[model samples]
Target: MITLRDVVLRRGVKVLLDGATLTINPGEKVGLVGRNGAGKSSLFRLLDGTLHEDKGEFQVPAHWRMAQVAQDMPETDQSATRFVVEGDVTLLAAEREVAEAEASDDGERMAHAYMALNDAGAHDANARAQALILGLGFRLDELERPVNSFSGGWRMRLQLARALMCPSELLLLDEPTNHLDLDALVWLEAWLQRYPGTLLVISHDREFLDAVTQVTVHIEHAQLKRYGGNYSRFEDMRAEQMALQQAAFARQQDKIAHLQKFIDRFKAKASKAKQAQSRVKALERMERIAPVLAEADFTFEFAEPANLPNPMLVLQDVDFGYPGEDGAGPATIVRGVNRSVLAGQRIGILGANGQGKSTVVKTIARTLAPLAGTVTEGKGLNIGYFAQQELDVLSPRDNPLEHMIRLVKETTAQGRLSGQPTREQDLRSFLGTFNFTGDQVFQAVGSMSGGEKARLVLCMIVWQRPNLLLLDEPTNHLDLATREALSVALNEFEGTVMLVSHDRSLLRAVCDEFWLVSRGGIAPFDGDLDDYQRYLLDMAKQAREAQREQARAAEPPAPAPVVDRQAEAQRQKQRNEQLRPLKKELAQIEQRMAKLGDERAQLEAQLMQATQDPARLAEAGRRLKAVESELATVEARWLELSEAIEQAGA
Candidate 1:
């Protein structure tokens, strides 16, 4: 168990926790949540030993090993797999011991070292590391890529994988889902649910907290409050408690008013003067109930657009991707994407991490031109695009006010400003609606927290009064309160919305339909997010099995044992006879899979063409589902047969 009793923690002169006490039992998964700048990360630092309590007792079991994602960017050229494998400290130590024992030529020491290495799982370290990598959305080919070759966000994912690779009794994760896509986030949630250790994570992702946490710890007003059950349960209980508290406070206020009235009426009368004095004493001695003061929640809404353009944008067989480098042809990530963004439609873009969700959004936003074909926009169409790398577009040296001022000037220069405010004061007033007020609005944007920057971006978007919103991972930096507020605002907005986000709660709250961008094409997803999650899990399982098979194939073959030629020939003949039926079945499954694949592609094309015809769309969707189900069944059997044949040959 970990205990913090009467703990007082400080950052410089400001006290974050005062007389705060909390006890987390061993193997419990706890979520630590608080408002931005409310010491959640600071408390994490305290638990991770980077900081200590300023004036109280804090204790954890001395023997418990801790693991946390490194905050620093890795500069190593080591291959991704090797870098993650090295995070297994126990395995590394055991291997070092084995090397030393061999060098010393000590037989007993060598034997013990070998045992330790095996215990540490040295043989499967690469496999385990690769599993973590793949589950976090890395491709198989990236396993041997240099760590430095990945972007900052990808490197951070590798950092998370490294932390998970370490053997630990206590794990600390802060915002683990910020860099993950929906599929990767789902995989991570499943992984965390199976972790056999104490987890203390700080996250603004409500669904993630509800999924992985068994306990909730809230920090507010310099106190730590513990609650049983997950985040949803805690929210329900907390709201109920607040309601009861408010009722009590209202009753107390009435009693105090009655007492005060009585004292005022009798104080000047001699007969009741002593009674008045007694009343004063009673008032002084009373334990008054304080009124519940609600926290200042940030909320904003998009101004209704000047006009709604039906079919806001149309993609006609567009090849959505980036232009190739070095004079090469353009790279098409998602091809033949034919879709229309209709007014008042709420669409969620769904796909695996690298399957072109962002690319589709980017193409629609005109950040990337179509490699081929046309993107037609309706007349008077206005778009508000929140890119995944939105923060990078903001000038670091400028403040929120400056950013808004620049936006106004740019829009005016482009002659797109309709009835929007252009004055500096009007812009500042608008910034205040997003909680960027006073000196904060003038503060450098570079020094602001991620949440603040995200809010600024939203503020700018709202100012534009766009008829169509293209938001990509907009909630990645937003806290729970802000996300809920965003959901409400989005629902109220009278415009088309196309969103790409990993936050399931937001997705469920905002999206009405889903489009799956996959296998170099786009199609309407007939199922909901739950079905998508199951599909991702199934895909992850297949990937892991494939990786294991590849590892087995890469291993050096064992030396052949001495045997009689006649006996070997007899065994070989028996193996060949056994494999004949299996091979035939395997070949048949392959042919069926190929046929099903072709049918699926044809059905998808039909579905795309039939979007406007309800009858044709329904029929195509039904056939596609059937084809997909049969393909899955056939593929599973094919894999089984292949594995069996490989074992028999061995």
Candidate 2:
């Protein structure tokens, strides 16, 4: 267990935790949630022993092994699998012992070392590492690729995989889902559910917290408050508690007023002078109840567009992707895409990683031109595009006010400025609406946190009064409250919205429909996020199977074997016996898969009909999850059995 009693912690002169007390039991999956700068990360630092409390007692089990994702971008030439495998310190230690034992030629030491190595999972280390890598959305071919070869985001994923690979009693994850796609996030949620260890995760994703965490620890007003359940439960309980506190505060205020009235009116009179003094003393000694100030509600709205363009944009036979280097042909990611963005339409874009979701968004945003088709915009169409890389569109050296000033200048010069606020004071006030205020508005964008930068981007977008909004992963850096605000704003906005996000809650809230960008094309997804998740899982499974097939195909053919009829017949018989059980299991798995598939389909249909009945919908969802889990298990076993059978035959 981890315990902190009357802990006083600080960053420089700023007190983060003052007399905060918390106790987290062993094996508890906890969600540490707070505002962006609420010291969640600092608390993690304390747990990992990087920081010491300035006062009072803080204790973690002394012998607990801890694993945390490295914040630094990994720059290594080692293969991804190797890098992740090396994260298992016990395995590394065991391997070192084995090497030393071999060098010493000590029989007993060698025997013990081998046993330790096996216990450390040295034999299946690569397999375990690859499983993590794949679960985190890496392609099979990328498993053996150099770690440094990946982009920054992917390198961060590798870092996460590395941390997960480690054998630890305690795991610390900060924003683990930020770099993950929906599929990878789902996989990670499932993985964490099965983790038999203490998990402390700092995340802004509410659904993720609800799915994985049983306890929520909130940091507010320099105090740590423990809640009994998940984030949603915390919110409900917190709301109720705040309401009660506010009522108590109101009652206290009335009492204070009554006492003050008596003291003021009678203090000058000889008859009540003693009583007035007594009352004054009582008032002074009374502990005042602090008013429950509403949390900094960061809410903003899109300025009503000057013009609403029906069919805001149209993509005709579009091919979305990046241009190749060295004068090569363009690399098309999504081809023959025919899509139209109409006014007031809310479309959520869905796809697995590397499936061109961003490519499509970029093309629509005009950041990338379609390789082989025409993109026609409706008359007077104005676009507000929030890219995944918000920084790319921002001038890091420029502050929020400066960015808005420049935007005003650009729009005015282009004769597009109309009723929008253009004055510096108005722009400053507008930025304040998005929570950028005073000195923060003047702070360099580059020095700001990701959430601040994202707010600046949002502020700029809202300032444009766009008829079409294209948001790609806009909620990646936003907290739950801010995400909720965005969802509300988007819902109320009088324009079309095309969003690409891994946040299912946001997607379900904002998107009226979904478009799937897959297999070099864009099409409407018939089902909801649940179906899409299952699709992603199935796609991952197929990709793995395909990679396995490719590996088998790539292997050189074995040299022709000598024909010894009697010996071959005996060997063949032995192979058949070895394969029989495996084959039977594979057949059973196939049958189970079919049964689960049918049940899933039926459940989905039932869910569609059960929308009006909350209880039925909940039950169907639960059963569907169970079926999917079983199906996944069976499919894995089937794959393993099939591989074994093939190897046995060979």
Candidate 3:
């Protein structure tokens, strides 16, 4: 559906894309993989028409629409729902026009209005909005909360939801999965699997691209290279290609050397002059092919935290709660909970928002004191904590280099290495591993992406090399690729870890056990994410069963010792049945919407490219619009289902 023909893009003297050509057909999902500063975002902008290539052509249908996932938040005071609905301003406008047309009773205009509304999927828009909101981890209550009240992570989700809501034949996503939790990530993966329109996604997540995309496009040295299959598949193919190319270059070098020797030996000999000249000419015409070099291996040298005696921290009968405003009332968030964090135990904490997971982490980190429980620090123990809000902790005015130097000294007062050993050089070398290079090292921390800041914070943590790592949603704003890389790094780290995260996959991959915090209590599970998830399902089922039993017991069989027994029984029965189907329907809609989305994308792309005849094009446009509208409708249904399910289950 889109093609970049011999594209050449340059900024000043640096060429970002040199004679690069790429083709994305309908229903093809392409992953654009590259390191930092390798033109991933620039390429997305080029496609979005925000930037232009110096040479070559970018071709798409005249009316083809495109949407890009925004990384930074736009200034807005609206709620998350409003933010998402506003993303497709065209749809909102079309809805208004369609409404007016229907009111006037103009057949032609009304028909156009229906198509517009259908294209915008006004019917299903709410469903899509709810699904996205939930998928992005927003609660029903939070959906109505003002966007400005949310943190950057939540703001990014709003942007993501907006992009997903828009109807576009082509979607350009850059690090789109950075802010999503496991549930949302899973939903997104499922959505992409069934997406029909062409997609060009830039991500650091290997497994994500592998699961969602069919093609891998690598950009390096200002050139584009295509590989069939997903990320891992591409890696294998690229490796083979590089090996073959290197062999070819080696043979060419040998031939050139031999020819040069012959030319030198026979230059003055009349009998061999013709052959020598021919060899020289051949050599002159030969275009040298430089062999590709593999990137340097990254060393994640963890600095160990200071040694402590017990290697264990325990919270004995902890009573914790959020303080009521002006001490009006006691709003207990957690109460009378006992928890033990042991040495060599990699525990994963899981819970819904506002369940006091962060509060628990804070209590353990000693950042917050328990209301009633005694928090005992293990002897000779030193803890290193990695918080989700890394950006908020740092001074925005200071550059990365300065921030690193300052943080290192502050966090690691007893850092093994004494004195600044070439601060600039050390900073550059350390930053380079995270893909920051040259002038980028000097850029203010404020200007960096969430992923960038996360990377920097992680790097700092590893540099200090703590004995026990306390990571609270460390993967919050990281791309999938980076997350996977982190998994590898954490796996290799020797120290114990205590992580409070919603990323089930990461928890499964890196954690050896689980510490589920709920209702102000910490429950330990000795298993992986699968086991933990099974446990949750079991618990939820138990809760449901308990509610049902209570309802049945509340109903009076006879009339003895009961006032209005029939009415009471009826009310209990009504309550029991209320949430059952809602949960089931929500689950069904979630799965169906993903499937329908893929189908709709396919249909939309076909409609976009099927014809040029005005009548035919117009019809196709209407159909495409309808499909998009239907998609939104599906999303809305899914949302209602989700809310219903939550209510029923509750």
lDDT of 2 at 473: 97
lDDT of 2 by residue, 1-650 (tens): 99999999999998999999999999999999988778999999999989999999999999999999999999899999999999999999999999999999999899789879999998899999999999898887788899989999999999999999999999999999999999899999999999999999999888899999999999999999999999999999999999999999999999999999999999999999999999999999999999999876888888889898788988899888999889898898989878888888999999888899998888888899889989999999988999899887999999999999999999989889847788999999999988888888899999998999999999899888888999999989898889999999998998899999989899999998999988888899999888988898888889889878998999999999889999999999999999998898888889989999999999989988844689878989999999999989988788679878988998
For TM-score, candidate 1 versus 3, the one ahead is 1
Quality of model 3 by C-alpha lDDT:
0.75
lDDT of 1 by residue, 122-180 (tens): 88999899889998999989999999999999999999999999999999999999999
The TM-scores of all predictions, comma-separated, are 0.84, 0.84, 0.72
Ranking by TM-score: 1, 2, 3
- Supply the TM-score for candidate 2: 0.84
lDDT by candidate, in order shown: 0.91, 0.92, 0.75
Best by TM-score: 1
Residue-level error in angstroms, candidate 1, position 168: 1.1
For candidate 2, the 10 contiguous residues with the lowest summed lDDT are 607-616
Per-residue CA lDDT of candidate 3, range 6-44, in tens?
A: 999986687999989988777789999877677888888
Rank candidates, lDDT, best first: 2, 1, 3
Q: Which of 2 and 3 is ahead in TM-score?
A: 2
Off by over 4 Å in 2: 265-285, 552-650
Please name the candidate that would achieve the greatest lDDT relative to the true structure.
Answer: 2
